[model samples]
Target: MTVFGCRICDTALTVPVSRVALPVHANQKYGNGPGSLAPALEPGTFAVNPLPSGSPWRRWAELEAGEAEALGWYAPRFSISAGPVGQVLLAPGDVHGAVIDPALVGDSACCGLDGGEPNMVCVTCGAPVAIRIDDCGLRQATWLDPLTTHVLEDGPGPHPVLDWADLIDQRPGIPPSEPGGGWHPMWAAAAASALAHLLAASGGDPISIPNHQVAKVFRPTLDRLLDPGSTGPERTLVLAGPDIPDTGGHFALIPEHPQTGELWPVAPPVKPIPLAWDAWRYLAFHRTPKPVGRSVPIPPEALPALLPGHRFEPDGQIFLSVLARLPEVRQPRLRAIYDRGRPYSYTYCSF
Candidate 1:
């Protein structure tokens, strides 16, 4: 296990946290009531139409499963699965050996604290140490920013390497889905956070999201933020990693090491789009339910579809907070991209 501490004061901020097997995706909610159903669909089987509500086909639908399977959904996206995975928790207090800054605590709509920013500072030096993102509905805990904190190797012996395949293979029973709540709030929050990282990774270049399904969720904000007039080479976002065969791509959204938080690089070295380890793992291994028109029924021997349009609006505050922490956001060209997209707004919604 590794102990994380404040960089400035070297104050031991957290205990040696290890990866624990979880019955569901860390971000997904498995409520005890009748409404919360686990997402049950294969990855890349669905496509989303990100157009406005006025558009005729704004809902999500299954891709031609045979073709999608053959082509492998040549876009960078995540799957929603009803399976078991691993997660880590870093709570505040003596039990976890964490010392959070009382002054740095920020209020959250759902929970009392929002750690998307450098909200947790070092008690000794007052320098930002980590982000504590335990809000209501979210798996409450703190995430130590690798840039601001140092992880020290300690404990009895070397920690066991967390095997991605093992975690993926484990299966847990599906959870109940909420009747009215179609979109998972935590999923939206995590996706919004990932979108911020993707933009910063773009380096002011036009990013091409091949799969319209995933693109629909992000394109609204991206189209507004990216420079249309720029002649820079276009970069395509592809999902490539150990499970998915890398058929040569410019950029990738790869998985992260569960225990260490180190990103697993895509083969051949393409620009990487960062995502939370659980998010990436779920996307890589599980199938997400596709949104369909209300009357449509599940197709036989093919991907399932559902009614109502699913919309994902990147939280403005979360986007800005994450963007500010990234060094790439400082580049003049990247800054121009943000500036050109005046009046930032994410309005993709599902009924």
Candidate 2:
């Protein structure tokens, strides 16, 4: 079993209680529509870059071969259509080897858990150790703060690769048959987080994003927050993923290493504008609108696919969770952006 420990106190923080196959990405949401079902690909048969060579999907081919090789693309071991599967598990009590620091807790409307800050700390050293996220719509988990913990394996094991097939297959299962099924809180939080990153990437200038589904979801919030009078060359927000092309000068939403949580850049030479990997994966592959009243026409190239059935609600808890984690979001001007919209409310349409 792999062991994760606090760097400062050398205390064992967590150990895998068990290992199970889960959707390769954490933030993916599957759809209820039959056409939206995730495509199943055989192991080792998928392409490292899934987009067609002539596909207008962005310049992922521009990535150096060395960089692509370094990513070690592979297929996911489990399928989401089957059930709730995961590769690792740590029991609740074993999640943190210490008491959580109250000061690090950030506000969350979903489940009242601190999704923004490091809620767990090393008991012996009093150092922040993990983020306890038990939010209402999200799968409860304690993400070890990579900055504070060191993960060690028993031996020199093969490093895991980024599996394109796994990403395509592992979206959230069907929603509960309750009144108004669960809205993906993480999606809103991720969109809000991406918006903050986009602003930072703009270097204090106005920017335009492509008219993709992600853009549709966030434009309202972005328009409400950005200043109309700002002056600078217009920058575009591009989707960067394993298959999408390199982001030439555009602001990129790149994938993350599933195991280590490190982001992979489209252009390896430039600094990345980080978006959660699962968020980028969702934006890149699942572009169709959620199944609702009207049958939204799908682009000829962007065919219908299985995606999560949750209603698209801008979650305040997720927005705050994302906002608090970013340093750029703390700036006085950027900090005020959240207030520009109608005060975030539990009911829909407030943000």
Candidate 3:
């Protein structure tokens, strides 16, 4: 664990926090009109997205000849972000010794940080050091601007290193339902991202997710999108994890560590598709009927959950965002499907 301090005054700005991989949904907007979101990261941990963030974007044509490959994007995008990198993340509540900049709080109807500009300043030096977002339709977090702060590298902090065994015992399961009567936003985002990986693993071949509950969430899209290829056995995706039993299958959808974003290791060398730990825990450990994201009020009244009503659709933007980063996306067969992703709005949807 390490503390973050002001570059000028050297005043400590946060509790000692450990590093973790940036989540796919850190910048995802959950609902339309107005809504609140849970914090993006746990209090004592932080994540850094190596990919660029924000705008002053550059299109493919604008990049210098070899710059596209260097930037890690192989496919064409409307525009690529050219913003600052190495911004440190923290839960909004973890921030201390900072004041919200009244001048910077956005004037949008959401009435909080719209993530347009820095909204918090370092108290010691009055430097714009953090962008604290608690606005509607956005993840709640505080991003310590990379250029304005520095880390205090000293002795290890008091936080303990939790292993897989400890996490399995300590972490609670994630219910698919949200308090506001929809799917858990994180669940929706993670599932969408994972769905993209499953598509890539399909290798342009047809695949089946064996679990009916899992099938309901993914199969509709799978059946509709993937062109059937010459096949002997269609690839199968089985749900497997900490204590979940997986019969022999072509692929396994396993839990990823929530803190470190590390994919769980499985044997027999079956390719892995990572699901969020909490969501996978609920699926693997609790084998009851699953709840649908739509039309069900939470505070359920029984044992077996009601059969899901609506076909689950992964967030389109999230699907494209995850898939666009894959090396396979360079293949024209795969690239065509990627082009059909509806999130971009500009892309014409075949379905």
Candidate 4:
């Protein structure tokens, strides 16, 4: 067994709890500061994607470098003795895959530092760290919630780590076997594709749920659900359709096309919700579903009724237009949008 240790403070740790095998996050500077704290994981537990299952020295180096910079901490330039070390547990090598090793040390090894509190830190760097090993070998469809179990009302089933090749193998669920319903199958596929595309573009090795990839997948899904004839779920309509449904602060999609004067589903522009800036928002353009920019140039007839007594002036359009162009992936812009107010004009279809 090889033990990992931090040279800075002469602190030594064993496998499953040592610097070598343990998950680590820096706590240096974030948005102008000296990071968060040393071994931020000491007081917390966090997941690490694409664990060091194989000899991914280069990948590990890159990850450590980037995370270190973000947290304003650096890896020590030293190696501790591997002997007298605790078990060296390897997490699943792939994010899209799974590891079904039951004895690989469950959550016991990654126990919280502050008397079981999830939040922890390294005494040396004060960065957050969580030493966990995922079962990447056991691939299966999963719910949108990453932490969810297989048998649930979540996203997909047996969602084994699917790649482009894998997509072709399975006969994707066809669009609602019957038309006139919300984004049933096709929407789900587009959403999935979009998510895959975004993840690839964002330099994400393996897509993480609720990440930019997921957001991309959400776009097409929203469009499908927005189709007026779509019967995806009246309940989901509150989150996807134009006019706010009675769902109350839930996500909705536009049912019809606001542009091109067609019934095609429109990809609603992602928006932040008020009061809950961290969440997404969806709104109606006219009586029809209008997802932010996805439904620009509201029909003259629908605009009046949709605005409902509001001055149908260019000012309102301009304000909404400006808001639509905000960046979704950018952290700062996203934060600002959330600071605004949540309204029927915004969409909240995805988690």
TM-score of each: 0.51, 0.49, 0.86, 0.19
Q: What overall lDDT, based on C-alpha atoms, would model 4 receive against the true structure? A: 0.25
> Against the true structure, whose lDDT is highest?
3
Candidate 3, position 307, lDDT: 28
Least accurate stretch of 10 residues (summed lDDT) in model 1? 46-55
The true-versus-predicted C-alpha distance at residue 216 of model 4, in Å, is 13
RMSD of 4: 19.9
Candidate 4 residue lDDT tens string, 186-253 = 22222332232232232212212322222333434233222345333332112332223343322222
Residue 15's C-alpha lDDT in candidate 1? 48
lDDT of 1 by residue, 1-351 (tens): 556676677887754544332212333332323232222212111111111111122111444444323322221112212111111234443123344676666554343454545566766677776555545434444545555566565453234554666645653212112357464544454565667678777767888877454465567767777778878898888776557876566778765554445666765558776554555555555555655675776553245322125554555534543454466665776555444332442322110
Candidate 4 or 3, higher lDDT: 3
**Deviating ranges (above 4 Å) for candidate 1:** 1-160, 171-182, 267-269, 288-308, 336-351
lDDT tens per residue, model 3, 148-202:
7888764344556567778778886677776555667777777878888887887
Better of 2 and 4 by TM-score: 2
| Per-model lDDT | 0.49, 0.49, 0.74, 0.25
Q: Judging by TM-score, tell me the better candidate of 3 and 4.
A: 3
Q: Tell me how many clashing residue pairs each candidate has.
A: 16, 20, 0, 78
Worst 10 residues of 4 by lDDT: 137-146
